[model samples]
Target: MPTIPGSRTLSGRVLIIFVAFLIAALALVGRLAYLQLIKAPEYASMAESSRTVNVTIPAKRGTIYDRNGNVLATSVDATTIYCDPTMVDDPREMADALAECLGGKSDDYLALITQDTTFVYVKRKADVNKAESLKEKGLSGLYFLPDSRRVYPYGSSAGQIVGASNIDDVGITGLELYYDDILSGVPGKMVYEQSATGIPIPNATVVERDAADGQDIIISIDIDMQIYMEERLSQGVADMGGSDGTAVLMDAATGEIYAIASTPYFNPGDLSEVEDGATSIKAITSGLEPGSIFKTVSATAILENGKMTPDTEVFCPAYLAVDEYYIEDMHERGDMTMTFRDIIRDSSNVGISLSVDEYLGYDKLYDKILEYGLHSATGVDYPGEEVGFLSDYSEWSMTQAYNISFGQGITCTPLQMTRFYGALRNDGVAVTPHFLVSLPQSGETPEYETEQIIQNTEAVPTMVDMLQTVVEEGTGVDAQMEGFTVVGKTGTAEFALETGGYSTTMSNRDFVGFLPNSTSSLVCYVGVDHVPVTGAVTPIFRDIMTFAVDQYRIAEQ
Candidate 1:
């Protein structure tokens, strides 16, 4: 071909343009093939993540029932509101709408809706009505899922024992925490694909797994008795002008707790109203120095050792001096002769101290304490059960020995004291205190083993007689009932101060006893803390015992 002037140059330019286009086209084809073949799985995954959602389906929590089949705790149907943040069109408006319906600061909701994620929880286990209210507003990107809320029917009744769960229905305290795994069943899940606007596409790939419901629990608590005990305890604490109180009623023979109550109890349904120490079951958790009531254990040890008889006489001074400590009787009295029986009936600190020092000895008394399970937890079925503190007998000084004889220089929970007394009233056999009656789901019955804590069965009767004398004509006289033979001991412990001395203005007063002649007698313990008087707790015991006797017909039995 003949080229004109500048034609050759134009042809060269055209050729250069063609070569550049060919190279660019080849690069484009290579890039497309590389992406479609080698990088296909990675891109596919990214696309799948944007459109697919995995939703958790919560399993229904179980119900808690009392011995009488009263519902103490249960779960109700609720809804959880979630959203696809990527699908949200106007996050500010949606956040304001959510705050209006669900009760929160709009800023907080706004933060959640503006998150850079496919999905996020707006509210978990919210009230169905509230969730529905928000849904009615037709907010885009919002979704609802089924959930459950834990509820307590009786409110503060048995609140500490029954415990409570969190917003996620996870148990966090008391029996609920103790039996969480069994109460919180396995959760299910749903996997599905959604559109850009977060709606499930028709015939989309969906997979689901079923949830397993939690097992129901039936505890040994008697709701009626629990309510009655709580009422009496609250009234008693108020009447005594005390800071707080705790009480327990148990079958003397079986150690099956019928009613356990603590004053200033918290409402499980509303934890916001709870005060410090209100959620603790003081009967099993708090350790306090039990005063004259511990004399019963000393008396039992003295008699069991075969070293002292009920008629054995000891001279009691007004006060016994040991190591710069003068242990005086609750009441001032001149030196007098007292029998073992008299020492207990009068709650004579000096006499019991002499008896323990002269007869029971430190090692034997400590041995007896251990034998009665005073050094360990009662093996209660509830959570957070604390045992009494007792330094080894080898660590005791002479003054400490005498102090312990009359319920000082040592500490124990009210439940431990009740269990010890129960052994005395239960023919020297102590049964493990328990709240679990049966697991109906597994058809399982828990074993409550009995131990011969007081080996001298014959000595127990004498101990019982001495306790009866306490109610008849002694410090525990207020615990006496007109046709009932009451056997109990009274305690007045000085509250220890953090400043290395006992509080002069406050004391823990308690009464523990049982009806001896009644069948299936209940060993009851009532304690009031921060009381000014030594005998403020006995009347509470009297009132509760009277009701129990009449309700259970203990006298007739």
Candidate 2:
């Protein structure tokens, strides 16, 4: 305890140093505790994210089959190549390798591999062999995942009906778009830990979910008949010098489509060659003026109202005047008296107009149009079915009535026209047209029950008799088949012009009918648009019907 001159000062300095050291030690310990306990999860998450990868696996799309189990559309196994750009050592080298294996520009692949993101797709749904070729090269940061590619085996045969899918196996058009949900199944996920070089760490954290495959669909189309119809339609369109053509063959009683085709077909497999407006199915989508073919409906209404019989005589002039508008027949002749049968046999526009004015008024004819489902869609299972254009009875003028009586000033799809003829063939009952035959996985079958469209059943046979006469002696004379009585009607509708009046130069020639005596329950409709001739479609109908009769071995009555 001896006090020197600087002893007290030195002791004070030591005490200050010790106090500062104690404070600093305590602060360091507290900081360590905070980091080790509180910030542990946050740091661990950051580390985990740096080394872990989560990948999505796409599910397989469904198969579309014909009624005979022929595959029209399906999904095939493929590979998807992806990569971690961060792990790629040389973007140019990898890009060059990919280009050689996959047939793409190296610069494009280079841009993808040089991306700042951790993962990017090199190619989706690549050909399996090509992907395998790249995998064998052992390119760094590259990965391959099992994928599916949509394939159409029949090509353009049923292209419009079956539709096509996009590169990612998503439906974009046709039946594919309609049933996309049912065809695209649930996707899966895979979570795995990997190294910084993009290699999986063995015995590390891994989680996976298996993908569910889509359901298969069976449609109500006979592929053989479809092929035949397409061939005939193409040839017919060429022969008639038509811009386009549509043909539909269906079960007369069931309304199940046997064959449906449209010309200028697009291949579902290769959409690049598809022309604009070629994807739409004209049978249900395009509405055309039905022309004299609609006379069958007019005749039916007249007989059903009991205002006229097949023998009911009406004076038919070359043309009938209706309030400054004259309705003339396709061909002009002298003023003559004609029975109801003769009017249909001659397809006389004047005769039908007179009968509608005297017997069936505009209001009743409008009612018959509604009753025949001409004013609405046929409620087919397919998408984009158009509801035909029909003015309300309240909106009808005297000229409009006359024009409508002769199948003018109105528009309807060929399928709708065919369905109306189907009602006549099916004893006044109109069956709903559909393409879905069955749902195999769910064991569900759609019921297409026949509904009575024509109230007076007796009028159906009388109308059928008149239609038979059309093929035998009228405009449909070319449609007559040997040893078969073809009951059909011919239509030559003037195309509407964009300017104002209808086009006198171009027309949509159509024929609709069914064999009354043949055992085959088939009704056919053939339409050629922009045809110069009047009866161009009748010969096409005759050819298709003859083939159908032979194919089905239809017994002659």
Candidate 3:
């Protein structure tokens, strides 16, 4: 009765609809099976990534120690405070509270707390006292991470040399920059389960990859000598009313720098007010024309070529014309006959020109300068080292030759000069200057290699004797010590002006030599700039030399 008109057609239509529905459901089931069986691992990893938190563990930086095993730079445990700004209930209030406890402006904290990022740093390497104060507030959505901060125990002592690290613990300059790869240890990872809002779920299983700490480094610097040299050099600069100064002490035989400082000091601990260009280690970085100090090279060339002996005679006048220039003696008047040794002892410009041209010749003089490490970088293990400036001998005029012969017209760093002096003290065998003594390797002691620059061993003693005569009875007499044989040369040269001629008001007064009384040879170089007198730095050199001889227990005659 119900299926009257078109009842058969209606039933057929309903059946077709039912069959179509069943087919669609089967297709859906097949799709679900394919996903569950074939791609289970991929979907599982995607889900895990959304719920798990991965944190990086920074490696501990290496410790820096002086030659005597005194720790100069190290790392200390610290806490870094972080938070999810999205999870914070009231960012302004939280920032205000944090500012009161952490000693920063409230606006700065507000900006950090209101950031759109999921994670933001509130304070890194926080002080324990401040962190405890913030903890007492029991703030929500805030977390603390274990971190390490760089520390310099000796404060400003050797600060520029050791340098400083950035907030992320990357080295920026000096030895730290040079040895960054060796000093930065291996970083690690940590993963843990977290809630929807990014907070770690308590009691959840945690997996961590432990970080390997960096190796400890031992440098060749002796802190005692460093302190002494810096103190006296600072005082000398002040007393002489000079602008700046640099000093270096090295083991003549090995080229190991014992104490090297450039005034004023750079404080690595607090870098908020670091002066521009103040952190440069000028001993190896700054190059200047050394006045009479260069004469030693000429004197060496003269003797090495067999053109003159210490007793050989020459005539020195007040001034002499050469090429387009006139070379003059600094003080003495009238023509006088003097021994070849007296030329260097008196630091005579005319005498050097007469000998360098008449006897040593240009080719031999140029070769000797190259042998002294003056024409190239000293190959030091530090960053930003400079090479000496020397024109090719083929381009040399008579004036250039005479100027170089008298230590003018050429430029070299204080480190290069000290290295040359070291060669004179070490049997004429120049060594590559270096600061690193060892670096830890595979839990074993550090390894090292040696480099020699010169091979003429016999010439060392002869030059040493000649330099000794300068200190005994010449311009370097101010550097003389009571019981030690001080061998060195004094130099006073005006700064070359950028416009043309030399500066009338500024000069570099210097003394470079070694102490032979010590069991091991010690080379020292002192430079004072922007002063009127020439020998002002010699007394400073004397004080440091005397102290070194006494402190190191060097023998006295």
Per-residue lDDT tens digits for candidate 3, residues 173-240, read 77878888878888778776778776767887464788777777888888888888888999999888
Cα TM-score per model: 0.90, 0.92, 0.91
Query: In lDDT terms, how accurate is model 3?
Result: 0.82
lDDT of 2 by residue, 1-557 (tens): 77789988999999999999999999999899888999988999999888888888889998999999999999999999989888787888999999999997999999888988878989999999999999999877898998999999988898988888888678887889888898988888877788876677888745488889898999989888888889999999988889999999999788789889888888989977788777878898878899989999899999899979989999988777788888788887989999999999988888998899899887999999998999888988777989889988899988888889889999989999999999888888899998888889999887886789999998989999988888888788898889998999888888888899988888988899989877877899999999876446888888888888877788777
TM-score winner between candidates 1 and 3 = 3
* Prediction-by-prediction clash tally: 0, 0, 0
RMSD of 3: 3.3
RMSD of each: 5.0, 3.7, 3.3
What TM-score would you give candidate 1 relative to the actual structure?
0.90
Using lDDT as the measure, the top candidate is 2
Which 10-residue span in candidate 2 carries the lowest summed lDDT?
198-207
Worst 10 residues of 1 by lDDT: 548-557
lDDT of 1: 0.87
Runs off by more than 4 Å, candidate 1: 1-47, 104-108, 196-199, 203-207
lDDT of each: 0.87, 0.88, 0.82
* Order of models, best lDDT first: 2, 1, 3
